[model samples]
Target: MTDDVTTLAWAYLSRVAEPPCDEIATLVGEVGPLEASHRVAAAEVSDALRERTAARRDIHAAEADLNLLERRGGRLITPDSDEWPTFAFTGFGGAAVRERPQGRPPLVLWAIGPARLDEVAERSAAIVGTRACSSYGEHVAAELANGLAEREVAVVSGGAYGIDGVAHRAALAADGPTVAVLAGGIDVLYPAGHSSLLHRISNAGLLLTEYPPGVRPARHRFLTRNRLVAALGAATVVVEAGVRSGAANTAAWARALGRVVCAVPGPVTSASSMGCHVLLRGGAELVTRADEVVELVGRAGEFADEEPRPTGPLDGLSDAEKQVYEALPARGVRSADEIAVASGLAPTAVLGPLAMLEIAGLARRDDGCWRLVRTSP
Candidate 1:
């Protein structure tokens, strides 16, 4: 019965690709609706599937693999299974099912991990960003992942390069469990370069996919998969992204689901930082350090060491100078406007203290913006 239900579900997903209701209804009709709530109008479903001829073919091919896997003694998990992830079910329920043409959730999820999906994702955060991330971006991603892991928080991300790669590596390096939700089949590492990382995650963390083995990733699938990343995590953080990058899609999905969205602020001039800045301006939490990321996850204590201590050269300065110094970030540049906002001081008051700090070599201007510089001999 599990086999039959699983096959029918896989076949249905293969048919609809992007949640087409008519195709799903047809499959549900053949499969007997597995559950009563999974139904939609056939005509509306058909219209939604009007332009997906190629996707339909891909679905058929994947169905064949499901049959092969079943023959090999592999088990299937339906929504009714005891092993089915409760958190995923919650996401399914919270998802905008009304907006989808199919009016159905995923047939079943294929997973390989020691921890149950719900347990692993009890307080998870998705770290997503560009494949071509800068060094600064990678550093921030690693710090955030490491902090989350040390706090026993699971880190979730796409198993891609740049930021994702760094995030996974940091979590693993810290001996923390992480989950990699793929756009392609779990068996097929899309970029190919991260095969080792994928293997490590399968052993130490979890590897998940909606697609069956041997299926390759398609363009639309990547966008569709982002929703899973957002839905699975308690919050989503974009370390870096281009203005129109897919990370934005994840942020949007997170927002729609009422999940906290966080972004690491980078150099204002960087093209990669543009997306994060946009997110920040749009009300996403502005995080320059890992503690800020942790705070968003309600795990601020995990990165307490990264927090600045109330001491050092500023200790010798007056209360007003200390206020100005405390206002400046530990790294990167900030305009006077930012300092004013952060310190709640007028621009006139900030200017006097800014000069005093500069003379003391505790701060310096780079490219017309002031930054807190570490004192040196």
Candidate 2:
């Protein structure tokens, strides 16, 4: 919880300047939110800061906004709040982020849910992709989300259609915590069809945004909100994306913040997968399953994927044994003389390998004829 004065100041400042306003954020960092709000109101800040807030400075809605948030059962999370994720936003202080206002951290977040921001972000992974997704993309997103949830790793995603929607629903279906970083206010559910989904998210997970109540989702706001989605997650996974999609923007933010970027490969002919293939070519980790993603974001050695190995019964056979096995007909039996001819081995030598294969259950003898045996993996 935030104190009355401080919360009001944060709310005021949040509205005064659009988010990612480096100038205002810098001013607040220097003089604190309470004084910063007063300075902006009094026009005592630098020209750059003053100009940014000029249009909305006098339109003070702190109290009203707070009341609306409370009425809706939401919280105003300021830097002063216990719920603020300081560790997750540490990268916002990096030189790269400071150079770009779009990548900077938020001054205040409007959130609604039962989960704590910091706790949910401790081991979270952001799953994002384009709004127009194929069934393949949807399946992959759901699988990754469900798998991460089962491992107790929170799933973070924009609460939009396609990949983001699938990820959120899958995480909730698995009875795991998830966080939906919205582009608009927590109260303003964009993509009207997802209104029910958004409310359900608020009940089970969290609906978070930097925008105040009544702020509708705008194009620029969605792009600006990408930074938070990237920052909150330890890793960002792009399940499917076009060459130029919002998911790609989120991945770029993750890279800029030094977070692990993972991509799931799709068919070579899929236009929807071009972005992921581009990422893979540029050295992003190629993640096909949740275990692979967990290995990158989870604690070292905790969720490591097992090394792959051949599961065939012939895997450990010697060259001679393998030749004998291969020489055997897949659907029918073959005699010793026929096997020897097919394997390029002596008729007498074929007997020993055939005996080995039969003993190993890789081959079976019926009426003294050898036929290949198919074993379940």
Tens digit of lDDT per residue, candidate 1, span 1-377?
A: 87665556554554345432445545555655433123321322344344443345333444565665455334344555566654332232344643553233455566666656777766788999998899999888999999889988888999888998999999999999898888876568777999899888877888777666666888877876787787777789999999998899988877765577888889999999999999999988766655555555664223222334456566678545776887888888898778876875556567888889999988887887899978753
Overall local distance difference test of candidate 2: 0.87
Per-model CA lDDT versus the true structure:
0.71, 0.87
Model 1 misplaced stretches (Cα beyond 4 Å): 1-77, 86-97, 101-105, 298-377
Candidate 2 lDDT, tens digit per residue, 1-377?
44798889999998888886898888888989899999999989899988998999898899999999998899998788887886434342467566777767788899999999989988889999989999999999999999999998899999999999999999999998999988887778988999999999999999999998888899999988898999898899999999999999999888777788899999999999999999888767788898777766864222123433455777888666887998999898989889987886667668989999989999998788899999887
Give the C-alpha lDDT of model 1. Answer: 0.71
**Candidate 2, run of 10 with poorest lDDT:** 300-309
TM-score of each: 0.65, 0.78
- How many clashing residue pairs appear in each of the predictions shown? 1, 0
lDDT for 143 in candidate 2 is 98
- Cα displacement (angstroms), candidate 1, residue 156, comes to 0.8
